[model samples]
Target: MTAPTRAAPAREWADAFAAASNEDPEIQAHGKYFTCTYLLDATERSYAIKMESGRVTEVTVDPGPLDVPYEFAIRATPETWRGFGEPVPPPMHHGIWAATFQRDMRLDGNILVLMQNLRCVTRQIELLRTVGSPV
Candidate 1:
């Protein structure tokens, strides 16, 4: 039998996410004005992703509390995040809205920024299916 599959380490996940976001056709198509910074807090680890004009400029993995500033944050228990990292998530884990209401996921800070870049951010979150979770 084959070994169980595993998620990539935080740094590798970060790089893959950045590449995937930059290369995504949907993101590039509608993200012409999608500029923002947001945090993804997975309880055990966090990532600060900065997007500028449809491209991922930087991804700070496990940044300190004061190291990076973001307009919004999506947080969840690692278990909840694992649901998101699946190739095809089941039930409430399929999207942020469902997860927020059905699971332990939380949307914090300036949620307006999240709504402002809703399309791109949604696509970005789906990148987890490819890059997997960081923690």
Candidate 2:
């Protein structure tokens, strides 16, 4: 047999994330967090919501595409939180988990919403773990 064909890694990853976001029951029920993944390639950059639930909490800058092979690796933890960061955020509760992969770099497009989603997901997970609930 010949080698298995692969769609562009970035595109495939994006598609998978989109599908997950669309079909996730937990997200639909919780109505809270939101998370996204962005990929920058030669011609352009793409963004999509990967997961969402609670409210957004954190955002990390992506390493420039040139220096980083896949552009960025973003993680979010969503939780049910209604107020601002006055009391310290859940993701930050772990003591600043590097908002961006590379502090010196930034994404090419408007990713504020995606960033919020990531934080929401991460925070929610934290809440569940803290309460001894399966995430």
Candidate 3:
């Protein structure tokens, strides 16, 4: 047998996500939080979020190359800086409220991305929290 090789690079996860959409009449009637599409801008060398309503709802990413489709647009908050000693907002927590936002509001996916980024940018703040300091 020959050596196993790596899998093909992902054109973009968005392609699969879009294909999974349920177009059933019943499913369509049910409201969703937000819809939007994204594209990789080779010129900008970054992914761009395109909104139908000037907003972004939810996005899920596994790993590797993935492309998301342009769909619905809903207002979504990316990352915001908080004071060191200040507590995080309830909406910011990945709890039921946030979950609702994810399901109903379509703000579910990309949570891990947000958390990972937060950890990177707020390392000092997190360290203080770990030490029993208010944050």
Best by lDDT: 1
Which candidate achieves the best TM-score against the true structure? 1
lDDT of 2 at 64: 54
Across 1-135, the per-residue lDDT of candidate 2 in tens digits comes to 777522234445344434443454655555543333343222223332233343222221233535323323333321211111224444433322343332322344545643454444444334322222111
For model 1, residues 1-46, the per-residue Cα lDDT tens digits are: 8777466778888899999999999999999988888999998889
What is the Å distance of residue 95 in model 1 from its true position? 0.3
lDDT of 3 by residue, 15-61 (tens): 33232223223223332322344332222122334322222233333
Lowest-sum lDDT 10-residue window in model 3: 77-86
For all candidates in order, the CA lDDT equals 0.89, 0.34, 0.29
TM-score against native, each model: 0.93, 0.29, 0.22
Query: Which candidate, 1 or 3, would have the higher TM-score against the true structure?
Result: 1
Cα misplacement distance, residue 28 of candidate 2 (Å) = 2.0
- Model 3, runs deviating above 4 Å: 1-9, 22-27, 31-96, 99-135
- Total clashes for model 3: 15
Better candidate number, 1 or 2, judged by TM-score? 1
